[model samples]
Target: TGACLEKKRAHDREIHLHEQVEKNYARLQELEGQRDGLTYMIVHDLRTPLCSLISGLQTLPAMGELGADQCEVLEIALAGGETLLGMVNSLLDVEKMESGAMKLDYTLLDASELITCAISQVSDLVLAGDLTLVRALDSDLPFFEGDEDKLRRTLVNLLGNAIKFTPAGGTITAAAHAGEDKQSLIFSVSDTGEGIPEEDFERIFDKFGQVSSRQGGRLMSTGLGLTFCKLAVEAHGGKISASNAPGQGSTLSFNVPIKPVQTIAV
Candidate 1:
């Protein structure tokens, strides 16, 4: 009877251990759900001011008293509006992704064409900063199946950050090529800007994490660009990473699988 009791106690202990692990897991899920809820609320709240600022800036240009000084202020206002709008959009996009609501509409796309269009969208900012933008896309790069919109957004965020952080005379380059195995497309955005600190490299991809050590404090950060890039790349079954370039800048790169899909005719 003593041996039987020992076995019963051992079984009870194992069951208790399993119960404890389950309880901890449940608690973790609860905490994560709460965090996501708070994030959604905060992102939703930002939309109001973002819209208001954008609208106010649109009205500023029409004000009758606009002089050179006023024009400068208006320009600043316009830039701020753009920044706020971008931040709100990034936050909402990430929140949607986290909630599993972001749907990827994959289509066969020419990588070179996509990069060209994305760069054009941000050409004004790059030119305004007097930074040279270059593209080194492979002419023979094959088409890949993916969500073009999200991929373009990820590239834009990377390029925008590159342009924003780089000095006026610095260079920003976007390059794409076939991966070593030719089964994936490897793309990178490099800028001759203030490099990222070694310790903050990974943290920079975390939500609300920004590179604060740069000369200009938060000069070009809403703190969501890299985070959004991480999410967007992962959503498309890709890998994204960042490292200090050989010289005076940072390089952000990602690899998306190059699976071909049948072309659908309209």
Candidate 2:
């Protein structure tokens, strides 16, 4: 009788454990479904207004009745519109990638060419911010297989952050080097501006995490760029990190495997 009672108790415990597991699994599925629905709704709703705003702002320049000051204000408004559109597009692209919906075309991308185009895209902003841009691409760097558009966005985000944070007369430098044996390409973006404090270095890479108290404040950004960078790099199966320069500013570096990524298509 004693042995039978013990066996019964063990069976009851196993059944209770199975019931708890089922409950937790159901909760997880419900939460995931809610998250997916929210993302879809937000992205869908953003496009309509974004299109209207950009279209109306674009038409303003064609009207010649405005004064110089008015035209300048219009230009600023249009610029803000473009920035918003870009942000929305970026968010959607990130969602697609996260959902495994983005198809990446893997091709041998010329590092030099990619860097030049990405830099040109943001050259105006850097110049307007009074920051000097510099690039040093190792000629011997081997061609690597990756998605060109994604890499371009990654580089642009890095350079844009550098320009935005660095004060007047600061310098932003980008360097690329190919590993001799590991078949990896290492790229680093360094800025000669206010450096991030030691404690906030890792925190800044976290999603929606801001280093404002140490670097500046929330007035300048929405804090999404770095998070996007982190996600893009991970999608490419690469690692990224940030470190403070000895005297001033910070360096954000990441590497891509030089050889073809066999397991993943992108």
Candidate 3:
């Protein structure tokens, strides 16, 4: 009878420990949610001032005939401000998407028009980097229903990522084609840059995940670009991925259903 009583006490202690573990886990999740809310508020507040700064910088060029040096300096400052604003907006959008608060603004989109517009937006940067921008889109890309602005931003983000790692004289190609099933369209951005390590293929999509460049050191970025791209694609009922080229560089691709069967609450 004493041995049986000792066994019962041991079982009670195990149950207590399990209950404590569950409580701790729940508290950890609650703390994380509060931290995320705080961060979102801070980032949201930053957008207003950033926009005003960028607007002031934009007006300076048209206000008067600026000297060559002044114009160059203004351009650089404006670019930086715009980039920061983009990062802030991305952080907010990512939060909304993760919380299932963001809704898709679906519309009929022309594949060629979408690709062309995205390329045009980044063409100046591509040219400044001494990089070649190639278009490998299929001729028969059909009209698709999706959020036009978000999809364009996704392509731009992918192309921008390519431009960041690609060396001078390297090539960055933007390609689009229908999937074999004809139910979706696949878009890819491939760059002839330092290839990604096989280990980082998935991690790169995580928030704030950065990878070291083979050129020398760690690549500088907010690292939310790919995360935004991933969320945007998945919200369209699609999938995104990264892969290495045979000899060098890497490709980032995503497929959006031609007719989305369901909306992702992500």
Candidate 3 per-residue C-alpha lDDT over 1-266 given as tens digits, one digit per residue, 9 for 90 to 100? 99999999999999999999999999999999999999999999999999999999999978999999998999899989998999999999999999999988889999889999999999999999999999998988899999998999999999999998898999999999999999999999999988887778888899988776666776645289999999999999999999998776999999999986563665
Index of the highest-lDDT prediction: 3
- Sort order, TM-score high to low: 3, 2, 1
Worst 10 residues of 3 by lDDT: 213-222
- How does residue 123 of candidate 2 score in lDDT? 92
Among these predicted structures, which one has the highest TM-score? 3
List TM-scores for all candidates, in order. Answer: 0.78, 0.83, 0.95
**lDDT of all predictions:** 0.85, 0.80, 0.92
Q: Predicted candidate 2: what Cα RMSD to the true structure?
A: 3.3
Q: Which of the predicted structures, 1 or 3, would earn the higher lDDT when compared with the native?
A: 3
Ranking by lDDT: 3, 1, 2
Cand. 1 TM to true fold: 0.78
Please report how far candidate 1 places residue 177 from its true position, in Å: 1.0
| Candidate 2, residue 240: lDDT | 85
What overall lDDT, based on C-alpha atoms, would model 3 receive against the true structure?
A: 0.92
RMSD of 3: 1.6
